[model samples]
Target: MLTSTGKLLSMGGKPRNKSLSLPFLMNISNTASKQMTKLRTLQIGNVDVIGSRFNGQELHSALCAEGFDSHHLVWRKMGSDAKTTEIDYPFKTPMNNALKKLESDLSIQSILHPAPFAIALNEHFRAADLVHYHLLHTGWFSLLGLPLLTKNKPSIMTLHDPWSMTGHCSYPRSCDRWMTGCGDCPDLEVIQLMKKDNTHGMWKAKRDVFAKANLEIVVASKWMLEKVQTSPIFSHFKHHLIPFGIDLEKFRPGDSEVARKKLGIYPGNTVICLRATVSPFKGLPYIYEALEKLSTTKPLTILTLEDKQLFKDYLGKHQLIDLGWLEDSNLIAEAYRAADIFLMPSTAEAFGVMAIEAMASGKPTIVFEGTSLPEVTFAPKGAIAVPMGDSDALTESLRRLIENKELRNSIGKEARQLAEAHYNWKTHVSRIIELYEQVMSEKATKANR
Candidate 1:
């Protein structure tokens, strides 16, 4: 039998007012479910576990573990040459092959059109007691199918970045483009397109579709939450903040000496690590500049997970170690343990998952102060949050960590404690379930009315 807690709340009695604030709604959800009936949940997203770049894998894993009827949907163009292969990793499974086959049959253009994908998604939505969406703005799945899915169900959308709010998929700086509305885009010329003028029109159409869906917005960081609050496109939707959690058992501190040996770092050499796929937004250039200034004086080894060719091209015979894509959790933990300091100077970040992972591995982190990095690090005593894009501050902070062993150790210990207390997967997943229940209940009540 299909039962909804939200329906019961609506029937139980009328409140003084129907409008409830987030805290009140949360309180009601936490308390309401115990007295009411349970409902089946449906989660929607592009969850390719083998594809390491997307957040969908983590979210789907967490949801399934919490006992939701999580159905992953992948939409790609049929007869297309796009290769949908599991990233080159050791543990390839039958499920990966199946997903690849399914992806092969799906058409990208068909996925981008509302009618067909909507018809397919509606079959699942009809069975679901509640719906959740993990949205990526530029994707065919989100652009075409989301409106159709939301029409029949109570839905919530999680925004991973500021792309949807602006016309551009991502804007690291220069808020002016998004603020005034996106026309005459800097990226457009690269595509050999002339200046276009649908900035306000495009966003309004997108915003209207999203706003009409009776959906709520979820952001991963307070920084993002603040931006959403200020944005004209997103201000109307109900907003919530939920940060990503790390698997502590895998990421926790390991033996530093053992880790150093495995990574081939000398026993006592100070190791500074930055773990990210190479991208301009990641501030690799700043780190390279900082390294050049300190390299001659300090016996330091810089390590990163980047393409070997790209790293070599960037460094140009500079003595640096490249560990391409370490997927093994233990090896990643060991890499963190082996490091004396972790550096992340990203110009734009939604949340610093890597920073928390490094913290769990008992390493002090150096991060840029302005964006979501500060929110993740929380300005821990061991962490040094330098002004964003300031190479000199980064250099100074790097030198300080290199010089002061006691300070590094002290901060690293605090960072580990913080991760254990707040950033564990168990705590995070529990909170998410609570929000899911609340949203579901509220939807049911509205339906009953």
Candidate 2:
């Protein structure tokens, strides 16, 4: 039981006061009844992960599978030539384009078809309901749509990264300037020609809007929740810690020999794999350093589906087998099975989804302590966590696993069990439903009074 002020209320105990509190007891009974009733919810997001080849897409699918009326509102950027919708160029589409499209769709739908947020909020405000928003501080969405959706609606915002909490739109671990309100930004010239003064103003505006939103802030990791709680941006909002989930059925253990054969690897050599989208934050440089230190005797293969040129440039004289982009889940699962250990040396992670995916595949994961990596991979029997940025520790941990097959098998089995218990999608979705019920019942009781 919980009080109206968000504190836990005691049950199964004698009343401390002389008053029996019939009204309070009656309220609790009525709240329980309201919780059992099914609810219709609206989920607002700028990206759709189901059809896209990204983690956010996978998260969207998982939430939809959990019985929410989840609809993804994507941004499509308008072009200079509005008439020319088709493009012949082979250049990768910019993210700004996507955000623009989402805004346009939201505007159009609210007037005619009515976007999910507008329709759901207008219809369900008096009923048991919730509005879940993903990535609320991505500039375009926050500036245009967030104010409209959150003005009178009971809203929850999930922080996918620390961009919203900080003044810098991009993270600051790589650059020192972002730590102190993001003036003289390194990426400013790349994005647009903005004066340092203008950038500071923009960041302040964003921060102010976020502070006044009155949102229930949901963080994917405890590390993130702690950071948000300390930060000035979200210190006032209610915080909830809910980690993302993985599909265990799609990422389970399989025959190593068969998996290796399918990937055309030799029958004898041990495999060490790293799966990431060739980004600097993923710490490809550290992996290269560790591999170079272990190259002489380990005879290990490093497999990734990232850029071949970038990997080759970072790892000179070291061999890296490029698998290219893998869209199929089964093939990815087989690749995980073929590997002896999964390596991730990320400098900063909101939550290490790849690490959990590897563990679900019954493979022991090697991650660094600090950040969200330790939080995700702290299962003692399942993972080996080394100090962050220490190549020596990484090399030693990898060498131990390479030498001992029994230790590897033991850790791998434990990792799979941990994944089944905590990282499963079903478990996460159930918790979310419970939270929704609890919050909605509280709202309903307050309204009746």
Find the candidate with the highest TM-score and give its number. Answer: 1
User: What does candidate 2 score on TM?
Assistant: 0.74
lDDT of 1 at 187: 57
**Tens digit of lDDT per residue, candidate 1, span 1-449?**
00111122211234324433233332334443343334555555543543332435555555555455554443322222122211222223444454434433441111233322443435555776676665443333435455666676777777777766765445435455665566655653221122444445555556666666667777777788777777777777777776677788888887788888878886567888886556657887888778756633557667776455445643544446788776566677777888889999988888878889988888889988777888788775647899988998999988988999998989989999988766767555555665676776677798899
Off by over 4 Å in 1: 1-38, 50-54, 76-123, 142-144, 186-201, 313-319, 380-382
Q: In order, what lDDT does every prediction score?
A: 0.63, 0.61
Candidate 2: which stretches are off by over 4 Å? Answer: 1-38, 50-68, 76-129, 136-140, 174-199, 295-298, 312-320
lDDT of 2 by residue, 254-301 (tens): 888998887877667778888655565677777878876763454656
Error of 2 at 138 (Å): 5.4
lDDT of 1 at 5: 14
lDDT of 2 at 237: 74
Least well predicted 10-residue stretch by lDDT in candidate 1: 1-10
Sum up the clashes in candidate 2: 11
